[model samples]
Target chain A: SQTIHQWPATLVQPVGSPLSLECTVEGTSNPNLYWYRQAAGRGLQLLFYSVGIGQISSEVPQNLSASRPQDRQFILSSKKLLLSDSGFYLCAWDRDRGSPLHFGNGTRLTVT
Target chain B: AQTVTQSQPEMSVQEAETVTLSCTYDTSESDYYLFWYKQPPSRQMILVIRQEAYKQQNATENRFSVNFQKAAKSFSLKISDSQLGDAAMYFCAYRSAGLNAGNNRKLIWGLGTSLAVNP
Candidate 1:
């Protein structure tokens, strides 16, 4: 069985501070990884997705960026955080194009 | 471009009763995938059911089932004997089956519908 792990279940940071959220999957290799954000009582917005290492496709232009350093390790980072950047961040992985996505326990970041 | 639409922002149903949440999508591609994901207050996305465009038979999982109308572009989720645990934000998503790289496997999501189960 495959499992996804996301760190810092809840985060509180001041504005203009740097941010790093990591996600990793075990028991799978060369899986598709994705990062998504959800506002309070709203739908999810796709942030970034990677099919392989060193390859990232961003869905929207924003203050955040994503990277795939290792085959199963994905990181979401920001040089400077904005008030609007605070939300529920989720990491997901899939085996293939037709497979269902498996999500990790999200990180709730609060930017003050 | 493909788009998923869930018109109802919120819906409530009595416990043990049945409820149906509607979803509609627009796509030019013939082969694709549709999914229903449930997000409870915890906010973890849980895949409830999936339907393939090429299949005519509707897909069912335990108490959850989907009414897939390919021609109508409608895929609705029906929950039988709804429970309080079923209360959550339900999202409809579409994925293209194209073999192209980059954006082929990305899921197009809807605004989602919040379901409330009343006892």
Candidate 2:
């Protein structure tokens, strides 16, 4: 069975601070990883996705960026956070194309 | 551009009853996939059901089933014998099956419908 782990279930940081959220998958290799953000009582917005190491595709232009440093490790980072950056960030992984995505417990980021 | 729509913002159902959540989408591509995801208060996205555009028959998983109307581009999720645990935010999503280079696998999501089950 594969499992996804995301850290810092809830985060509170001041404005203009750096942000780093990590997601890792176990029991699978070369999986597709994705980052999605959801606003309060709203739908999810695709932020980024990676097919392999050092390959990332950004869906929206914003303050956040994603990196796939390893086969199963994906990190979402930002040099400086904005107030609009606050939301529920979710990390997901899939075995291959046309596979259902498995998500990790999201991190609720609050940029004050 | 492909887009998904879920008109219902919130819905409620009595325990042990049946409820259907509607979803509609617009796309020019013929090959594609549709999915319904559940997001609980824990904020974990769980796959409820999926339907391939090429398949004519609807897909069912335990108590959850989907009404897939490919011609109309409509996919709705139906919950039978609804339980309190079924209460959550339901989302409809679409993914293009075309073999494109950039974002053929990216999922486009609709505004979710919050489902509440009363005990």
Candidate 3:
């Protein structure tokens, strides 16, 4: 079965600090990966999606960025974090285009 | 510009009763996909059900089902015999369909409906 793993279930970072959140997929190869953020009492907002290595499409413009350094490995990073960056971050994988996605437990990021 | 709307921000239902959460989308594409995702307190996005645009019949999974009206562009989820575990934030999503050189599965999420199952 396919599974998604995200590390550091919760994070607390200071403003202007660098950030890195990693997501890895097991039992799948070259799957579509996506990063999403959900604010408190709000819906999910798609941040970035990668179809293949070194290929990323950003949905919302912000201080955050995403990279697919390796197949099945996706990373969300930021050179300088903002207060607005604080939210719950979720990583999900899709087998192919127009397919349903499987998601990770998510990382709760608190930027103070 | 594709958009999804979930009118109800919060909803409550009695346990063992049925509740329907409404969702509507605005799109020019004839072929697309609709989905309902449940997010528990753990924050894991779980696919509750999905409906393909071309399919006339609704999609069902155990106690969860979707009433997909392609013409009205409305897709609603009906939970039968709702349980306490069913309480969560339900998000309605939409994805465009096309065999593109790029990706065809970028999901547009609605504001979400918070379902609270009361005892």
Candidate 4:
């Protein structure tokens, strides 16, 4: 069975600080990965998605960026965080197009 | 860009009662898929039901079922005999069907509807 793991389940960062959240999937190779952000009482916003290593497509331009360094490793990063950047971050993987995405437990990020 | 809308921000139902949550979407693509995901207090996204545009018959999963209106582009979830565990945020999602044909497989999600179950 495939499983996803995300680190720093809860994070507290200050404004202008650098941020990094990692997501890794097990039991799958070359799967499509996605990064999503959900604000309190808001909808899940697609931030970035990648089909292969070194290829990242962003949905909404923002301070955050995503990268797929390895086949099953995806990272979301920011050089300088903003207060508005605070939210719950989720990592998901799908076998291919039109397939259901499996989401991670998610990391709650708070920017002060 | 495709957009999904969940009109009800919140809904409550008595235990063992039936409740339906409405969802509508806008898309020009002919082939696509609709999904309903349940997020419990734990916040894990669980697939409740899925409907393919080509299928004429509705899909059902035990207590959960979907009323798929392809012509109207509407997908609604019906939970029969709702339980306490059913109290959670339900999200409606849309994905293009022709991914191998250049359609992005990214899921377009709605704001979500919070469902409450009363005993």
Docking class of 2: high
Pairs of residues clashing in candidate 3: none
The lDDT of model 1 is 0.94
| Lowest lDDT block of 10, candidate 3 chain A | A94-103
Clashing pairs in 2: none
Q: Model 4, range B10-101, lDDT digits (tens) per residue?
A: 99999999999999999988888889999888887888888888899999999999999988989999999999999999999999987453
Q: How does chain B score by TM in each prediction?
A: 0.98, 0.98, 0.96, 0.95
Lowest-scoring 10 consecutive residues by lDDT in candidate 4 chain B? B98-107
Docking class of 4: medium
Q: Candidate 2, residue A50: CA error in Å?
A: 0.6
Q: Can you tell me the CAPRI class of model 3? A: high
DockQ for all models:
0.82, 0.81, 0.80, 0.69
**Best-performing candidate as measured by DockQ:** 1
Clashes of each: 0, 0, 0, 0
CA shift of A11, model 1, Å: 0.5
**How high is the lDDT of residue B90 in model 3?**
99
Residue B116 CA displacement from its true place in model 3, Å: 0.7
The digit string of per-residue lDDT tens for model 1 on B24-51 reads 9999899999999999989899999999
Which prediction has the highest lDDT against the true structure?
1
Relative to the true structure, how large is the alpha-carbon lDDT of every model? 0.94, 0.93, 0.92, 0.91
Least accurate 10 contiguous residues by lDDT in model 3 chain B: B98-107
